[model samples]
Structures are given as C-alpha cells and as structure tokens.
Target chain A: AQTVTQSQPEMSVQEAETVTLSCTYDTSENNYYLFWYKQPPSRQMILVIRQEAYKQQNATENRFSVNFQKAAKSFSLKISDSQLGDTAMYFCAFNMNRDDKIIFGKGTRLHILP
Target chain B: NAGVTQTPKFRILKIGQSMTLQCTQDMNHNYMYWYRQDPGMGLKLIYYSVGAGITDKGEVPNGYNVSRSTTEDFPLRLELAAPSQTSVYFCASRPRQGDYGYTFGSGTRLTVV
Candidate 1:
C-alpha cells in the first residue's frame, strides 16, 4: 500500500517570506505522479501543482513549485514570496500512472503572517 | 462548469438517522468519488464509481453506501449516522483515462449528534 507522510503539521511565516512544506511517500512503483493541493478556510480543494516521477524538472505554478525527488521519495512544495492567500491546509498526494486511486497525506497547515 | 455539485452544504443528523449526500457533475466525467475529511485531517475515500451503475467501496465504506445511476450523479448514503461520520464530505470526478487530477465539489459538512 502506498502511504504519504507530511512531516510538518503546522507552520507560520511572515507575508512575503518563502516557505516549504515537506512530504514523503512509500511506493514500490517507479511510474507515478505527485500533486500538491490547497484547501483554504473555505474548505475547497484546489490543485496547486503536479510533478511526474520520470521528469527531473520539478513542477511550478506561479508562486507554487514542487521539489520532486523520486529516488528519495520526497516531494515538497515551495511557496515563493508567500502571501496571505497562501495560508491554507496543504496536502501531498500520490497516484500511480493510469491508476484511479490517489493517496493523500495528513496535510500541513501553513499560515502566512503579516 | 459547475464541475461537481454536492447538496446540503451543511446538515445535522441524529443518531440512527439516515440520509443521502447528493453529488452531481456537469463535466460528463466517467469517474466519480466520495471522500470524507475529519477535522484537521486528510481526505479519506469512502466510495467510487467508474461509471453509471458501477460503484465500489473505498477505504472507509463501513457506514456508507453509494449508487451511480447516471454518469452525472453519484450519491452517498449514510445508514444510522454516528459521531464518527460527522465530517465534511467532498465529491470529485475525473475523466476515465488521464493523469489530470480530480475536480472536487465545495463539500458538504455533516454533523451527527
């Protein structure tokens, strides 16, 4: 079974500061996809970024990016120039290539202080 | 696109009561799913359907039931609601074949008293 572990349960940083949320997963398969999702106080789930296991270059979406270390089984999200809107519960998810099931980590509560 | 819609944005049910959480999508997606998020926790899969008339249990389907009568609608039913079932439920959908993540609903918060 694949399991995702998010080491940081909660974090706080001043607005305009950069923050990174760490995530690790256990999987035997080589071909898979990693994802970072954001859930604000509204409780709406939004996909922040996605990274393919075979791709060496990490995925970047505006201010959000992922450091996908496939060999290390680590996928972390970095928010550059973080803003108040970046405050949310971020989740790290995994899905095997072409598989319907996507496993998720507990999530890291990130707060951007002003 | 109204991607996915879950009804009763919030609800309160008493013990042993039964109710269904309605979910529907406008994207014509072939796969639909139900997941529950306990307070300050990750989402857990409750049930999923590949298409109309094809439904399967997910990780935590113990107190839940689901049916997919049409490609657009997948409703999750809770029998004899319990405090443990008091969580926010989200419905999501995706195309049958692709790594294109999931389109999720705003979520329905259910409180079982």
Candidate 2:
C-alpha cells in the first residue's frame, strides 16, 4: 500500500516570507512521481509542481519548488515570496510510474497574512 | 480550451434518490477519473477509466457506478444516495496512461439528506 502524509494541518506566514510544507510517503516501488497541488476556496485543484523519482534535481516553478528526497521518501513544497493569493489548501500527491492511481495527502491549509 | 468540465456544480439529493454526476473533457485525454474529497481525507478514488468503454473501480467504489462511452465523457452514477455520500466530487483527465499532467475540474458539492 502507498500513502502520503502532510504533517502540518495548517500554517500561516507573512506575505513575502518563505514557507515550506512538509510531506512524506511510504512506497515500496522505486519508480514513481510526486506532485503538489493547490486547492483554493473555489474548489479547483491546481497543479503547482511535480518531480520524478529518477530525477535528482528538484523541480521548480516560479516561486514554487519541491525538495524531493527519494531515499527518504520525502517530498516537500516551498513557496517563496508568498503573496496573499498563495493562501489555499496545499496537498502532496504520489503515483507510481506504471500505475493509474494517484494518491493524495490530507492537506495543509496555508494562510499568507498581509 | 476547457480542460475539464463537471456539471451541476452543486446538488442536494434526498436519501434513496439517484443521480448522475456528469464529467467531460475537451482535451481528448485518454484517461479520466472520479474522486471524492472529504474533510481531512485528501481524495479517494471512486472510479477511473483508461479510455472510452474501459472503466474500472478504484480505492472506494462501493455504492458508485461509472461509464465511459466516449473518450471525452465519464459520468458517475449513484444508485441510492446516502448521507455517507455527501462530499465534494472531482473529475480529472490526462492525455496519457502515465501518472502525470492530470487536469482537474472544479468539484461538485453534493449533499444527501
């Protein structure tokens, strides 16, 4: 069985500050993928970033980046220069390279305070 | 382009009633999925399809049915709505069978009384 865990249920940081959301997963498969998704109040799931287990280099998109440690089975999301719009529920996700299912973590409610 | 579209943004069903949650994708994706999101429970896969006419049960498929008659459409049917079925439902699609590039639709909030 595969599972993703987001340790933090909620977090708050001042705008322009950097915040990191922690995530860890338990999976026996060596080949897999990790993803971070953002769900705003509108109930839309937006893909923030993704990383391949085989890739040693972390994935970065604008102010969003992932620290993917395959051996530790840890994948975390860091939001730099966070803005008010960055406030939302962030979820860490996992999927096997060959499997059709994508598992998701509980989620961390992030608040960017001005 | 409309990445993924789910109809009936909100619905309320009485116990024992039945309804279909519609989902469609214009991206010509080969894969589609239906999942339910509960508070503090990320998302549970209810049903998924590899392509048109190819549907399968997922992690939590009980009390739910699905059909994919066309590549672009995957609708989930609830035979008998129950209080436990109240939650937000999401539809997603991707172009390939691989686990990446999933586009999610704005979820439908369903409440069964």
Candidate 3:
C-alpha cells in the first residue's frame, strides 16, 4: 500500500513571505503521480500543483511550486508571496499510473499572518 | 459545468441509523471517488469507481457501501451509523487522463451521535 505523509501539522507565514510544506511518500511503483490540494474554510478541495514521477522538472503554478525529489521520495510545496487568502489546510496526495484511487496526507494547516 | 454535487450538505444520524450520501457529477468523468475527512486529519479514500459498472475498495473501505450504476452517479450507503464514522464526506471525479486533476464536491458534514 502507498501512503502519503505530511510532517508539519501547522505552518504560518507572513504576507509577502515564503513557506514550504514538506511531504514524503512510500511506494514501490515507478510510474505514479504526486499532487498538492488546498482546502480552505469553505471546505472545498482545490488542486494546487502536481508532479509526475517520471518527470525530472518540478511543477510550478504561479506562486506555488513543488520540489520533487524522486530519488528521495520527497515532494514539498513552496508558497511564495503568500497572501491572506492562501491560508488553508494543504494536503499531499498520491495516485498510481494505472489507477484512479488517490491517497492523501493528514494535511498542514497554513495560516497567513497579515 | 456543475462539476460534482453531493446532497444533504449536513445531516445528523444516531447510532444504528442509516443514510445515503448522494453524489452526482455533470462532467461525465469516468472516475469517481468517496473520501472521509476527520478533524485535522487528511482525507481517506473510501471507495472508487473506474467507470459505470466497476467499483473497488480504497484505503479505508470498512463500514461503507457504494454502487456505480451510471457514469454520473456514485452514492455511498452507511447501514449502521456509528460515532466513529462522524466526519466530513467528500465526493470527487476526474478524467481518465493521468495528468488531469480531480473535481471535488462541497462535502457532506455527517454527525453520528
């Protein structure tokens, strides 16, 4: 079984600063996908970024980027120029190449201090 | 598009009671999923369907039942609700592509007293 782990339970970053949420996973498959999803107070799950295991380049979406170290099985999300609206519970997810089932980490509660 | 929609946004059930959490999607996605999110805990996959007729278990599949009769609907049934089952349930759907992401429903907040 594959499991995603987010070590940080809570994280805070001041406006205009940067913060990184760490994630690690255990899987035997070589072809898989990694994702970061955000859940705000609205309780809506939104995709932040994603990285394919076969790709060497990290995935970046505006202020969000992933530091995907395939060899280390580490996928971390970095939020730059944080805003108040960025405060949310962030989750790391995993999906296999041939399956649609997604496994999620516990989550990291992010607070953007203004 | 309506994306994925879940009914009974909030519900309260007592022990030994039963209820069905309705989930429907308009995107015509071939893959659908059900997950439960406990307070401060990450989402746990309960069940998932590859298409209209194929269903499979996920990370946590106990105490739950699901059926996928069509591509747009996948409802989860709880026969004997328990306090341990109290959590926010979310439904999500995704395209068949490996690079595509999932579209999640607003979620149903269930309280099992």
Whose TM-score is greatest here?
A: 1
Off by over 4 Å in 3: none
Tell how far residue A49 is off in model 3, in angstroms.
0.8
**Could you tell me every candidate's TM-score relative to the true structure?**
0.97, 0.96, 0.94
Error of 3 at A7 (Å): 1.2
- Model 1: per-residue lDDT, tens digit, A1-114? 889999999999999999999999999988888889999999999988988888999889988888888889999999999999999999999998867878899999999999
Candidate with the greatest DockQ versus the true structure: 2
- Give each prediction's DockQ, rounded to 2 decimals: 0.67, 0.69, 0.67
Model 1 Cα interface RMS deviation (Å): 1.4
Where does candidate 2 clash, by residue pair? none
Model no. 3, DockQ:
0.67
Give the count of colliding residue pairs in each prediction: 0, 0, 1
**How well is each residue in A39-96 modelled by candidate 3, as lDDT tens digits?**
9999999999999999999999999999999889999999989999999999899988
Q: Model 2 in CAPRI terms: which quality?
A: medium
Per-residue CA lDDT of model 3 for B1-113, tens digit only, reads: 78899999999999999999999999889999999999888888899999999999987899999999999999999989999999999999998847677899999999999
User: Across residues B44-83, which tens digit of lDDT does each residue of candidate 2 receive?
Assistant: 8999999889999998999999999999899999999999
